[model samples]
Target: MADYHSPTVIQPTIPSADMTALERLILGHIFDTEADGDGLYLFAEIGPSDSFELPVRDLRRAIAASADTESTVNAYISERIAALTDDDTHVEIDLSGMSWEFILQDIVRRSPTLDHVTAISAFTCTRMRPDGFGGMAVVITADAIRGKSTNDIVEDFLGDDAHDALYAGTHVLLRVREHAVKEQIAEAIGADPDLTSINPDAVTESDIRSACLDVVACSDLSEEQGAAEFRAAVAAIRAAERRDQAPG
Candidate 1:
């Protein structure tokens, strides 16, 4: 056989899992994954593979050298998506309409080949939600790409969902603020003798806090504002009671 000439122009191949991990890291940093209004949230610089294997730094360096890292990451995503099997079991979620938790469970149940790790890593949310406004993506850090718990991933996604709802100025904020006010007022009532003694037997602290929260929850106010209003309401009620007990 003639002398074999090694090709110098060819690039060394890395495992597809490693490529997926790095691509996810790059994409996560490029988009608004957490709905924080920050497009570039750098959770991790060098995400590790599922096996905890380190990627070839040179491959990362080459991508960084590219003029548009976004395009480079997209190309990698496309390549991976193309390699996916044509199995009918594979499922991707449209977070715009469906619940992430439900879809995640469905993905696992439907796709026998997908364990928790692969299911999470291969899920559409791991990259982007096609139906989201501007295709809102999820933050797939090294831990997530390396196979974090499904519950953790789902929880994070739910948190992102909440953030998105808040960022969009939806009713979710109102409900969350109201719930917080109720808890804060409950805690205050528990700690303050004055609040507890206002109507100990006749009216439960729970009832009082609920009534106060009703007024506080009318407007979308900060927890501090709500708490302040709640305190003031309790004080007024206390003052009125004291006047009624005063000798005529």
Candidate 2:
């Protein structure tokens, strides 16, 4: 159990040996400037590849200009292959999901020609929104807002580092609770203040719901919505009840 789910939840990587012949070729282009890219170059040269129809430059530019390091390039390639196929044998960029961000970011910076814009448009998500959001914030990705006006707004609200803002807002790295809610939950759970102060596991759902009502009493958030959203915000910690991320 952990307060925040680690990046390992999705693994986020496909080993070089596991990649299809064409995928290995695209991966080599991403790390073209890296000294360690030599290994991948050899793999691409030795390949007898299958048919692949991709906007080769768009995908390549996405990786070359992306903020991610070499490792993430591999992960992006993995995600691309997984998205396009039911089984593991195929590898192709479906031009879907956040994968479009790579090409879109590049397009916005350059001329947004008809063909270029058409290539990455109409992307969709295959998964549900994470419960960590609590509807308090929307997952506004960098590509979703790619103009001068949008940049200014995002800089003001989320600060200049839009990628970092997207990461922080979506992930549940910490939990926030009002002091009143803390004390009320402690009393309801009947646990020693010192033992349970840092972790509030024993508190029943009724107690949590009651404490949330106390929070709503002091705020404009509707009693029902406030309690539910508050619970959602702290869902990670509640699931891992006694887990503390701090190093001993």
Candidate 3:
């Protein structure tokens, strides 16, 4: 088995076909002036229906804008859609769990109308993608910090996204342990130097509890509260891990 808990990156993409017209317009507007915007175009009619490049800054803006109500966005798109004669126009924006924390902080700095709470809420929605098992998963890369001013990243996640959960439930992708936690866990569990170190399937509750202790030692949580919160986080990680390890 691979590192059952190592951070694995999965780049998510919204294909042109999957994107709403509003989403496409928002991206097109952002990428219009850039010369190296992959295939991104100012006009959807002229752009390819399959793929287009989304610059990091523009992608951040799009995620911020998406937090608005669906009707508000649709209204914006409706106003712009009249310019396109083709009904089949589409676009795709590729995204990953990486750099979202920095982008959220940037959004807070540049957009005065958006505060930390709103920006963080938007981040939750953008990081979420279908877990392919009728659920949604929030992709929190190893480097992505949960909260700007708070140490309890996992605990804050229990909060909803822009709207509601919008799926069966949401899980944080914590399979990849933080480097600090990784070293501690390896020593505590007596696992291999290589992070794939342990069999996820074989890990016991005692092992998970021990690992969770290392993760939240400095947290403000009392021992009992910390244990519960870490357990929730581990449960979510295990759920995603099971999906990944499921037999085809």
Query: Is candidate 1 or 3 superior in TM-score?
Result: 3
> How far does residue 100 in candidate 3 sit from its true spot (Å)?
11
Whole-structure CA lDDT of model 2: 0.39
lDDT of 3 by residue, 1-248 (tens): 11111111112222343333345554444323222222221222222122344344443445456545343334433443334343434424322322333432333333334333211221112223432112112333222233342224434565545325575454443343445554565476565556665654355444565777775674554576667789988998999999999999
TM-score for each candidate, following the candidate numbering: 0.15, 0.19, 0.19
**Among these predicted structures, which one has the highest TM-score?**
3
lDDT of 1 by residue, 149-222 (tens): 44566789999999898788333323334456556765776789776655333443455567767776685568
lDDT of each: 0.39, 0.39, 0.39
Clashes in candidate 1: how many? 0
Off by over 4 Å in 1: 1-26, 29-34, 38-40, 45-70, 88-248
- lDDT per residue (tens digit) for residues 106-135 in model 2: 332332222222211111123443432111
Candidate 3 versus the native: TM-score? 0.19
Give candidate 3's total backbone clashes: 5
